[model samples]
Target chain A: MRRQLLFTALGAAIALTSPLAGAAGDELNFDAYREMLADGNPAELLEMEGEELWRTARGPKNATLEQCDLGRGPGVVEGAAAQLPRYFADTDKVQDLESRLMHCMEAQQGIPSAEIINGQFLKGERGKLAALVAYVVTHSKGKPIAIDLSHPRVKEMYDMGERAFRYRTGAMDFACSSCHSQDGKRIRATQLPNITKPEGAAEGWSSWPAYRVSNSQFWTMQHRLWDCFRQQRTAEPVFASDVTIALSVFMAGKGNGAEARWPGVKR
Target chain B: MKKLFLALPLALGLSGASADELQTRVEQMMLDSFKANGIAGLDRQKQDAVQKACSGLTPPDAETMKKLEAAEMATIKWPTDGNFTGGDWKEGQKIAASGRGLTWTDKTADNNGGGCYNCHAMDPKEVSEGTIGPSLEGYGKLRGSSEEVVKYTWGKLWNSKAYNACSDMPRNGYGGILTETQIRHVMAYLFDPASPVNQ
Candidate 1:
């Protein structure tokens, strides 16, 4: 089968307006496809589930995440994810939204961090976390990415992230820069965003935590980064590790002022 | 090794010592963050001289480039048997097309793919090719199978950095990404008249 024709059985309407009919539609334009699925994004379902999980009283402590602080303040979900991967004074660690959420779950709800950390994606505790992520990022939709690198630790993470981006190792000898540093590049028809630049960083950073049509699952940014490392043929970074958070800090800080398009749909 | 960097700054009283400090810290961070899983291990995180040299913001100096290339060239394991293009082109097609192996979930390291199509266009019919490297559609047809051309191609596939110091192409043979027989098969896929790559 042609690679571009490998569209999933999501929307029957997509099949009707298939891009294959046109001469110029040889390759799938993800931008156009994203727009097509805008009204009916599957991430909305996960968002709803996340909202319920947020307010519900569960976990060992029998507490909801309603009082969890997401950088803005306790229980402030609006525009919070836009400025994530920031240094949290309470934890004294630079954390992304997922990592921050992990803290909240652990502290407020008495949920062990190990459960989510060691768990696989779209299953059990990790799966619930994915939903929560979808919910949290939904509030930050259309808000500018405003990461603060003023803190010394956050600055260190940003520096670490920049170095990590160029640090090529593994069997493939591939770095994030190998494919992403250049503009207008692709890996077998898929457009690789040039994440070094602000626009590219925004495009890459903001549109994730997405619902994938291929796998039929919502993937958090941690899952996305994990898979990137997997494809790089390097050892997997632990869930919400410093390396992952540092990489996030680099991308988010570089992507500051770009609008968040959270709960995105992807092929 | 860890203390050496910390001691250097204090000993020399250097003002801008954070460059080496950052490198050390990042290396330690990677070691701490990543854990070995199945086929993939923490050992892969450690960068060799060639990898480290090429990973810098700028390419290594001309002298260093030559040294790196020479060192990489020494690592290529040339086919013991003179016959390079005798392998099946059909098997080569599968090897080039696949982008699997060495990942954590992968069962074993053997039978890994060359992942050629990820960067270069091999078969004209295969539209799912990346434009990172030049197209190899008419590789054999354009460059005939002379002894020099065959040897050059073999070495190139084995370790691309041998020819170009910081070539983006992976060191397939030197890196143990593909086996000798698998590379031979890929050679056939590139040079064989019956191969779709030539057509």
Candidate 2:
């Protein structure tokens, strides 16, 4: 894979330039360097694989996920991710992209619900959930988030998510707001996006289903939330649970109207 | 007049119940939402008294904070040998810079990173250090070891919340994030003249 080559090349590059980064009073300009690498991001590979999986038919039902209705309708993935964690009338529950995909996987493709829900994100080699999420989110590229808060369930979820955002109960006493509420904050070399305001939330919300260079795999919003809780030292949230959906509703609502840039690349 | 007084108090209680109910629901949902997997377990959902107080809409009162601080202070296990800066600076550097441990991905909990670089500038040479906490670049150079300074520094490392109730820093000692030997190494990384942090 090109990513494998990129990693090899980068390793050599780091080895050669190790002396410069090790000097006294040297600012690595790592953020700018990351920006340069972002241009030819290898997320394109996952996007290609996702497109194939989305269109191809597999599983017991032997049917494509193309018929899986996101928010707009069946097979209408365009801009659907942005509007999600919204209430679906049929399911009668607010659902994010991963939960909805799980629904379609079981209902349409005949995959066992347990099979999909059991895997912990990033605990092992990347799960199929990450691949499927990458496929679905790529469809909504270059669109604005449009969460529907009118539905009663959606309204309830949004309220719960707001509380969840500020609900700081962990070994370290961290909430989503602890790290994300403040702007211009970083954890080591990484700059954390503030999810409090629309502009900040836009940057935060719309860039998941991203390719991670560290592990050479893609991550979804579900995995992203899971990691936040991990770093917060909270209980690992179950896949597609009410709490995860509630947090999604809160973030998606905050990030409303921001452009959806998925299959994103991260260092 | 009697009916009005009773009704008003009932209404106030009902309003209070709504927020209480939401809190209970979210807490229960969190308990139900996660399961024990790998090294992480459901017990992590359970919050301690300090965690519970900090989770509230308002900060804990000074009286409550003093009690919590006292409890936290008791958890710090001071090195019996009375040597704080005896560990190797190279080993200390590795522990201070590491940010991985206790997550599901990790196989074991031993040798967890202090994650100090994530929030503090340990050395002036590193550009990538975080700014959430104050810089400690010349920590030893600035403050030479009086018995008072050494003891205070060791206490701060053991339980930061013992000094500040709502510190963003983890109760590294009380929370069991690092071991006594590891903390000693970190202390050396801070106090040793040969360490880059002192330079």
Highest lDDT scorer: 1
Instruction: For candidate 1, write residues A1-267 as lDDT tens digits.
Output: 322232343556566665433413244456667787887777888898999999999899999999999999999999999999888889988899999999999999999999998998889888999999999999999999999866666777888899899888898888888888887777877778899899888988999999887667789999999999999989988999989998999999999999999989887
Q: What is the DockQ of each candidate?
A: 0.46, 0.34
lDDT of 2 by residue, B154-190 (tens): 8888888788776778878777888888888999999
| Leading candidate by TM-score | 1
**Alpha-carbon runs more than 4 Å astray in model 2:** A1-40, A120-129, A169-174, B1-17, B79-82
- Tell me the docking grade of candidate 1: acceptable
Q: What lDDT does candidate 1 reach at residue A5?
A: 35
- Which ranges of candidate 1 are over 4 A from the true structure? A1-9, A17-26, B1-17
TM-score (chain B) for model 1? 0.89
Q: What is the lDDT of residue A110 in candidate 1?
A: 93
